[model samples]
Target: MGLTELLFVKMTGGNPILQGLLGGIVITLMNTFGALVVLVWHKPSERFLDASLGFAAGVMLTASFTSLILPGIERGGFIPTFIGIILGALALDLADHLIPHSHAVLGYEGLAQTRLRAVWLFIIAITIHNMPEGLAVGVGFGSGDLPNALKLMLAIGIQNIPEGLAVSVSALSAGLGAHFYACFVGVRAGLVEIPLALLGAWAVHIAQPILPYAMGFAAGAMLYVISDEIVPETHRKGHERWATFGTILGVMVMLYLDVALG
Candidate 1:
């Protein structure tokens, strides 16, 4: 009976806008699922975690540079791309300064409070970072570049697993509810993509000239995350070797995907 009802709901396709909305929701849910797996199951050593993060940083950085920023420049030329990158970096920097959080604290605090705060901060930062990625996915789909779109989506999705685990473990060490915290963190990280997708689609339609800038902006934002968030957090774990390994692994994985797909 329950299955029948669900099937009926699934079968009933609706308006175009509604379809897009549903697609966005599905994508968000998929991303969340990936994050949840990382959060609940994986218990990576500090060294491994740091290496994994370094790897993720490498993948994202490469993707931002080669896949997004360079392409935007090729399509839109240098001046616009430069402006976009600067604008994107500046926007995130401004947001970081304006948003109140405990990113400054390095040492230990009370376990529960510390973990809770860390979990929330990690979620917020990743959520912000995912927005542009989601936007890129949406733009790719909107532009009818289905192959590239899927590639980006898959890459980002796989990358988020390690990211989610990193956030979850940090929070857990800080003394948060493992499952609940993971779920919320995953949901928060994934949900931002919806608005990003919508906005990207709209921007592509309304200001075609700005697409290069937009891509550059996303690249810049991603670079900031690599520098400010991923690198620093990885260093905190003091696992330089694993981190380096992870970094190399991540780069290779992305490179393979780009070659196979792109």
Candidate 2:
């Protein structure tokens, strides 16, 4: 058999590298298609959108905590994992604070003048966020723990779809070029994952000792996202109750999936 065939067989047998690639693809496609659908059906309501975004955030936060951080602690011991998590959160927090996140345009003059700039800013933030997300997925798959990795990937993918829609819908509400812009942003987020996955795979191979730290680091970054972006956005309209419910539901969903898959 040829090299391609050999690789294919390995993949079919549940290779970590293949799993990571598949996971990345799954997330990318979901974001792209989901955004497209949202663009096609445009209905903007602040309360509804906030609640939905909250739900997505909840799903992502739960997965990051349970699947990634906990596993890292279990494998790498408490002190190291805790340090890693702190460092990770600090790093992302620093980046988030330093980086000027783009907000959707409001007001007619603001919309007309800063539309493109806002779109680009949004894209950049999403890209930065997605890169780490992809890395996390890759790390999960590359760990040689197939079942958990697959479950995490599936969960993340599901969450990403709504995220895509949220971005798309938000842009549309701003009266910018929603469809094309959303597609571009969504695809960009997913593509950012590929390089991160490769890098994560290499890190795993080179520094086995740092693997848990890396996972913790990712969890920290995700936690930042949940706290800063997801929570605030979700409660934009005082739908705290719905957001809380969504978060609980998200945690339950991920837990159920983890159990069922395991």
Number of clashing residue pairs, candidate 2 = 0
What are the runs in model 1 whose C-alpha is more than 4 Å off?
Answer: 1-27, 38-42, 103-122
69, model 2: CA deviation in Å?
1.6
lDDT per model vs. reference: 0.64, 0.71
Off by over 4 Å in 2: 1-14, 105-116
* TM-score of candidate 2 versus the correct structure, residues matched by position: 0.85
Give the number of the best model, judged by TM-score.
Answer: 2
lDDT value for model 1 = 0.64
Question: Residues 191-253, candidate 2, lDDT per residue (tens digit)?
Answer: 777767666655764577887888887777778778866787676567887878777777778
Q: On residues 39-88, what C-alpha lDDT tens digit does candidate 1 reach at each position?
A: 44656577766776788787887778766777788878999888988987
Question: How many steric overlaps are in each model, in order?
Answer: 4, 0
TM-score of every model versus the real structure: 0.79, 0.85
Candidate 1 lDDT for residue 20: 28
